[model samples]
Target: MGDFVKKLKTLKTEVEAEVPNHPSIEMGDVICEHFAISKPEEKTVNNPTRASNKENITEKERNKRRKSEKEKALGVKKKQKKPCGFCGEKTNLHTKTTCPKNPNARRMPKPKVS
Candidate 1:
């Protein structure tokens, strides 16, 4: 009878430790309420690759990633574009009228030579 009483006391203590003092509210709910945070919304199933592929990324990010990948897989990344120099637009941040060099420009005196 004494051994049974000792076992019951230990079991009662274990139950008290596991259970919250409050009967109506749970521990996690209490924390969320104190912080004023709503319960997290459930997320739907997602396609793995669609998210990464559709992100709006700048050219610098693309180029940096490409260079690192190239260096890892192959040898060194041979050539890299300077800022705004990828498509031969080195002199960026200018309007078309004030451009220093124009490939399709004609001579000043249009018909003098002929």
Candidate 2:
């Protein structure tokens, strides 16, 4: 246990010595020195007409934009149909379980051996 602890301490010191100055240490010190320096400037708008004009988008354009934005944000993609293994037909309608050309449809039980 003592040897393990000694090895761990030596490893920690070696790592600290290898990385004498890291960006994280400097960033932490910079952040501590100027905590509120990164705050965004507040803008006060006096003209209500200008603000309304900025938001004057058509209903159809707004709907189209919203739909496109939603599709992009949700990562919506068109599904590609895969060809059937048995029939070689490209379809998204039927699966292997409901495929008409499935070989297992007319399968019979194997004969029991003594």
Candidate 2 lDDT, tens digit per residue, 1-114?
999999999999999999868555577567867875653457665556533323457767755543444464344234476786667777654455546778664443223222
Give the top-scoring candidate (lDDT).
2
The TM-score of candidate 1 is: 0.22
RMSD per model, one decimal: 13.3, 24.8
Tens-digit lDDT track for model 1 on 35-97?
Answer: 989776786766687344445677677655434443543442233423332234543232233
TM-score of 2: 0.23
> Candidate 2: minimum summed lDDT over ten consecutive residues — where?
105-114
- What is candidate 1's CA lDDT for residue 29? 88
**Residue 61 C-alpha lDDT in model 2:** 74
